[model samples]
Target: MATIDLTEATFPETVGAEGTVLVDFWASWCGPCRAFAPTFSAVSENHPDITFAKVDTEAEQGLAGAAGIQSIPTLMVFRDGILVFSQPGALPAATLEDLVSQVQALDMDDIRRQIAESEADAEVDAGS
Candidate 1:
């Protein structure tokens, strides 16, 4: 499996899709981001069940800003369109693999349900 190129156009469909998604937020000019690219690609190949996507901060500033990404090489894991984990930094390959496994082991159904409840609460607040 190869890493999926995530653009602002495809972000909603990709990240918000019903599945396990790993999004790598990066910029081409950042040294750490460049260094982590290959590792991210390799991880994508290694984990066929996980959807790995890359967001170019330079080109997709809106998406990056909305994600509140203040640094390069930020990895965010989402399960069923709900954020499960987020960290800023370049992780070693082994650590990155461990993160994927850890996320996979979590109760994704519960997370998704929680997210739905929060969203509903927000909607009610907005309407009030």
Candidate 2:
């Protein structure tokens, strides 16, 4: 399947709906982004169960900014509407595949809960 282009208007519904989705934040002008595009696309095809979407920083500035995207080819993986893995860089195909496998191995529910608890702890610490 062709990769989906995610913009601010459709970002939430697409990434936050359900299941595992990997969102690639990229820009057309970026060489690394161009190079990584096909690899990412191939991964999407290889893993039909996962939804792979790309967001063009140039076109989806708001959405990119909201995601705190500071570099081209930032990859974020979400499961069951909660973010699980996030990394910034161009990863080789094998590495990317391994990452997907690692994510699959994780208990995302506990991961998300831990993240929330950590954030709350930080907030409480800051307030004191």
Candidate 3:
């Protein structure tokens, strides 16, 4: 599958709809982002079931800021409409593949349980 070019408008619906999605936060001038593009795209083709999307930070400044993207080439993985991983830096093809495997192996029921517990804790903390 080809990588989807995500704008601020489509970001939510695309990432929220379902399944596993990998988002690359990048800018045109960032060297690391350029270097990582091929690896990301190649992985996209390898996993047709997964959605691969890119957000051009330069164009989506508000979205980048909201996402807390401190550096270029930030990769965020969303599974089951929840963000599972986010980090800044370039990843080699092997690392990307391993990450994909890990993400695919995650038990989303457990992840959801954790999310619910975390949210409950946060609410309790706020009530305190």
Candidate 4:
């Protein structure tokens, strides 16, 4: 599948949907972002089941800011409406592929349990 351009309006629904969604936050002016575009697009073609989307930082400043995008080439991976991985920088094709493998292997139920435990711990600490 070709990478889709995500806007502030479409961002929520797209990422919150079921399955894996890979979002690349980028800007045309950044050299690293330009370098990563081809790799991102190529990987998207290979993973037809995954939704690969791009957010142009310059065009969608509000969305980018809301997403905490401090860098031009930030990659955020979401699975089953939960953010599984997020990082900044241009990733090589091989590394990106490996990341996809890792995300696919994750046990989301365990992840959710951990999140709930952490939230509960935070709440307990706040009550102290």
Candidate 5:
């Protein structure tokens, strides 16, 4: 599938969708961002089940700010409408592929259980 152009308007709906979503935060002025574009595009074609979205930091400053994007060429991964991974840097193809593999292998049920436990712990602490 092709990468979707993400803006502040579409950010909520797209990221909140129930599936794995990879968002590339980039700016046209950044040389690394330009270089990583083709790599991201190539990887996108291999994963039809994953939704790849691009947020143009230059054009979508509000969205970038909301996402706390301090650097260009940052990558954010969301699974089942929850953010699972976020980092800064232009990763090589191998690294990107490894990330996809790792994301795909994640046991989301376990993750959700952990989150629930943490929230319950937090509530107990708050009551103390």
Candidate 6:
């Protein structure tokens, strides 16, 4: 699927859906962001099942700020409505493909269990 432009309005619904969603936070002025755009788009074409979305940080400052985006070309991967990966930098195509494989291979049930355990631990610590 082609990369879709994500605004503050569409971001939540698009990334919170059932499947995998890869969001590229970028600005047109950044050199790395420009270099990564083609690679991001090319990878999206190969992964039709995943939603590839881009948020222009310059235009969507509020959304980017809310996401804690401190750098251009931040890539975030969401699977099953949970954020599985987030990093700042432009990744090579091969690395991006490898990341896709890793995310696809994740057992979400185990992940959810781990999250629950962590939250419970946090609650216990808070009470202590």
Best by lDDT: 6
Model 1 scores worst on lDDT over the 10 consecutive residues at 106-115
**After TM-score superposition, what is the CA distance of residue 105 in candidate 3 from its true location, in Å?**
0.6
| Per-residue lDDT over 10-127 for candidate 1, one digit per residue giving the tens place of the 0 to 100 score | 9988878887899999988999999999998888888898899999899899999999999888999987777889999999899999998888888877777787899999999999
The pairs that clash in candidate 5 are none
Q: TM-scores of all models? A: 0.86, 0.88, 0.96, 0.97, 0.95, 0.98
Q: What lDDT does model 5 reach?
A: 0.94
Off by over 4 Å in 1: 113-128
Q: Candidates sorted by TM-score, descending order?
A: 6, 4, 3, 5, 2, 1
Q: Rate the local accuracy (lDDT) of all candidates.
A: 0.89, 0.89, 0.95, 0.96, 0.94, 0.97
lDDT of 2: 0.89
Q: lDDT for model 3, on a 0 to 1 scale?
A: 0.95
Q: Which ten residues in a row have the lowest lDDT in candidate 5?
A: 11-20
Q: Candidate 1 vs candidate 3: which has greater TM-score?
A: 3
Q: Write the per-residue lDDT of candidate 3 for residues 1-128, one digit (tens) a residue.
A: 99999998999999997799999999999999999999999999999999999999999999999999999899999998999999999999999999999999999999999989999999999999
Candidate 6 ranges beyond 4 A from true positions: none
How do these models rank on lDDT, best leading? Answer: 6, 4, 3, 5, 1, 2
Among all windows of 10 consecutive residues in model 2, the one with the lowest summed lDDT is 103-112
- What are the RMSDs of all candidates, in order? 2.4, 1.8, 0.9, 0.7, 1.0, 0.6
Model 5 misplaced stretches (Cα beyond 4 Å): none
Tens-place lDDT per residue, model 6, 1-128, is 99999999999999999999999999999999999999999999999999999999999999999999999899999999999999999999999999999999999999999999999999999999
